[model samples]
Target: MPPARPPSRTPPDGPPSAPLRALVSWALYDWANSGFAALVQTFVFAAYFARAVAGNETLGTAWWGNMMGVAGLVIGLGGPVLGAVADHTGRRKPWLAVFTTLCIAATALLWFVRPDPAFVLPALVLAGIGTIGSEYAMIFYNSMLPDLAERTRIGRWSGWGWGLGYAGGLVLLVLALYGLVRAPGWFGIPHHDALNVRAVMPLTALWYLVFCLPLFLFTPDTPSARVPLSRAVAGAAARLRGSLRDLRNHRHIALFLLARMFYNDGLTTMFAFGGIYAAATFGMDSSEVIVFGIGLNVTAGLGAAAFAWLDDRLGSRRTILLSLMGLVVPGTAILLVKSKTLFWIFGLAIGIFVGPVQASSRSWLAHAAPAEVRTEMFGLMALSGKLTSFLGPFLVGWLTLATNSQRLGMSAVIGLLAVGLAGMLFVPEATAHGREQDRA
Candidate 1:
């Protein structure tokens, strides 16, 4: 069905509207905290958590997947409801502050995770808490996009944010590799204690807290009326219900989200398991993994920057569609290679496409959602991406358990990419009449 005309709410805030300092400050959050994502979630700690904590490669991989599965369940269900609450409260900064503290504290605390079986569950739980803090915080962070820059430039801003995140991750990974390579005890800590790996947690926490101040101190926020907490909850619930009821009327938004839900599952699964899969499949130690991570981050940073203009010129839908198509081919080819050389080549392909898929998806959401409900819609956007977020992880865990082959387990992501691409074909172009006016 053709979507009914959307109601009015979005007001354009173009480049002239948002100062460059505020724009950089806004984007810097992506740059600041991505070290946690690269080090903990994607590379060093995930591998360490699985191999060192869980005690066996196969079981550790499964447990790691399951841990993230649990995090996904929490993030998927909570993001929308919380987003609705934020929309009504008109207090994005306060919530961002709370979650920022939560994430930083949680990351720094990972220094204490001992290499014992008893530590696994608690470690996973802590990681889950950090994941929630970062992911939940982004519900508010992302909602600010529509108001930060005009429609024509949203993609550029989104892409740069993503690019900066990759760059941040890359820089941290390089530092980490240098530290590890110089000596296991390079920081005056003994190698016997495994402190080298654990040391990064505290450092990332420090890095994130330091660089994130600009956005907290500088960027402006939406004005909202004060409502009692109890009343706000009731209002948010009603708004969420209204959004659900109105989905059919906003069919393209619904489909766009649905497409994202599937592709994001694949994207997230690749990230969650990429380190473990590489380590298990290729016998890559910490130093090698860090190098691999740095390579991917470099390509991803460059790719996101390159695609930002493409997203604006070609439209968000086509840009995302192209990126997803790019994913399928590389994702399959990775399965065929075992050497570091071949893996790097194919892995970089994954890197190049992944950024465009993410940046354009955000751009599309910013373009497609109704203004009044943009925050709420982005929340649902998080919900959609995360709701089935477990399916891919659980499958990777379960398949690896059953088959004892991480290669076969990794293949699960390609199907999701293909499915999402097919779904994207059904979404209407973002330039529909009412949305077009919002861009102006």
Candidate 2:
């Protein structure tokens, strides 16, 4: 094992009580980007692609799975390196801005994807680009957590961000459903060639671009390290190598990352396929899936907000364990029930757990990672969440094709979730003071 490095007593940027405006601005970025997750990735566009673009639900599902698998691989491989480079350079916002623009542009261009089978590759490519943008942007965004709030309040802020994200998804879904998809010729958008569905693409892009401004304007960013770009790039490899070596002395974080790797993959698979499965298995249309998505978002937002206190009080580990149990039970039940009504019940129940699992995981890492290498650690966090992420989607897509059963394909999530839960059992609870002791 490598010799343990001394702990960093470096305080977070800003006072313990960070300004409310900065905090809210930081949180709203979550709300902004969720437009993409809600409309493009989950409800509106995903269903449309499967049902309309590919002209075959099964083929579209498989293709979408493959596309996401590739995106995950890219994100996993690039995140740590980019994070190390950013740490050397000492600013995250510029990187965030670049990727955010990429996502917005890709989302806006999705408007050109018509209801023709010929557009399948274009649609997948655009969505893949957008997904990559959103995820890479998140590495920097999540790294800012420790700087935005003190350890005592990190859970609350993380939860608030997630809750707001879900709320944003809910609101966007409603607007897309009632104003765009369900409405006939709203704002002069014609019903011809599925233009109404395509219109949601631009709307999502506009929403993200508009709401993301506050973070750039109001949220405080890390001070520049003044390292030249060339120098930062040159040193990134060495820094990343050292960061990986240092992990040997931080077994708790390593274990937690491993546990997160499996559970997050389960979550990613669920997000990618939830709408596809609903439509393919239940014969629901795009509009119906949007309504279902709205309800799920409502429950998820409330659960995240409510659990913010629990994260701090019960500790991040317990909170995550409870949330995982909540997910595994209802998630399993949803697969068994043939009735759509039961699916709704179980699906909504699953949503309640989703927010806590994500929020607490962020808080857990915030409390655990040493301050000096925080961004690099978050990059590793992204790697853990994404490295094997392709496996979940690939398995689902493969099984869906091989067995011709959406139900059986989705069962892949259950095993992943169960494995994550068992892994969590061995990880010690993380706290702000615990981090101090690790450094000692």
Candidate 3:
């Protein structure tokens, strides 16, 4: 198609299967930072921000959504450009390291965000930094899919990564529940002080640092290109424009990213607000929310492991289609159900499908991306995902504030998911077997 390009990275030369050590190391990166996802984004900090910081559940939820929307906007704008630079330089690890450090540092700084209205602006700023950093780092991590597994096996590996991430999240959630929520004063931090909750921020940062080490040490990334940063950016922009002009050959991939963008926006909005949703809607406390997070993580971990195998067998596109539909049913159900028990049930459904949807989406792109531009393509994928990313959260915020009904506000996600599902009808699966045949 395009000219033959060099490998994205100078990974070890071997058989089609990646070495066990390398694979595990790669997957552990997911494990490393999941604490941030569960603790900061989904479970603890988000709820705390809404209730404790913002001072009112409804307004707090709206503010939290607005903060995430802003971060998504910046990420959407910058992800592709940064990804192109990485591809051109042939060095993803350095950029990843920089962003990971930012994520960890910003997350740690969140420990200082207190209940005063004076702290809300600073808290939002730090949270936005962490969110954008985490998101940008993932583009490079996701690009590794092409290097880590052969086309036939990428889905399973992607699933393995996600499952382990959820497992990690579950472990951290349990620990936080034990040390902070359940016991209240187990760590010598008074319950009234709420240091128990704030302390978890630094711990999550440390956990991310420790687990991420294996990847930095063991997983070899591309060697740096000698090109200057300015030239790399210019070159990347030119290539992207050329690719856009050649959309006929890339139509299916284009559709998939477009579909992924909308669906992921809905999914992100659901996740960003889930903890706040439960707290406001059901009056669930910290302990109950932690339990919910644990259960969902457990279900998602198991589902990720199971669906990974299914992805290869069913075809990545089919697997993703099933996962998207799976999300739609429960996502809508959340709007209907009032009981905490029913919310838990539907939340588990969301968990079951979320892993597969993510894993297969990546594998689908990895299958089609030329080796030369893997990082760039994944960045574009990230871009698409972040482009309308603000829409779901923004809509949720607006409706929640206007109608003063959080549940009714969440219904907005269903519309996004349904449109994405419709878009999939045009996304023809470009089979891996055909590519293998071409290679022969």
Q: Using TM-score as the measure, which candidate wins?
A: 2
Candidate 3: segments with Cα more than 4 A from true spot: 1-15, 433-440
The lDDT, on a scale of 0 to 1, for candidate 1 is: 0.84
Query: Model 2 clash pairs?
Result: none
User: Model 3: per-residue lDDT, tens digit, 1-440?
Assistant: 33233354522321276677888999999998788889999899999888888888888888888999999999998898888778888888888899999999999999898877788898899999999999999999988767767777888999999999999999999888887767744676666656778888998999999999998998877567787888787787777666666555667777888888898898888889989888889899888888999999999999989999998888888888899999999888888988878988898878999888888888888777767777878888988899999899899999999999998899888998898888876777747642211211
Please, what are the lDDT tens digits per residue for candidate 1 over residues 243-273? Answer: 8888877888888889999999999999989
Cα deviation of 150, candidate 3, in Å:
1.9
- Over 1-440, each residue of candidate 2 has an lDDT whose tens digit, in order, gives 32233233347432375699999999999999998988888888998999999998888889999999999999999999888877777789999999999999999999999999999989999999999999999999998878878788989999999999999999999888888888663576778899999999999999999999999999988888788988787677777787887788888898899999999999999999999999989888888999999999999999999999999899899999999999999999989999999999999999999999999999898888877677888999999999998999899999999999999999999989999999998888886643723322
Off by more than 4 A, model 2:
1-9, 12-15, 185-188, 434-440
> What TM-score would candidate 3 get against the native?
0.94
Off by over 4 Å in 1: 1-16, 180-186, 432-440
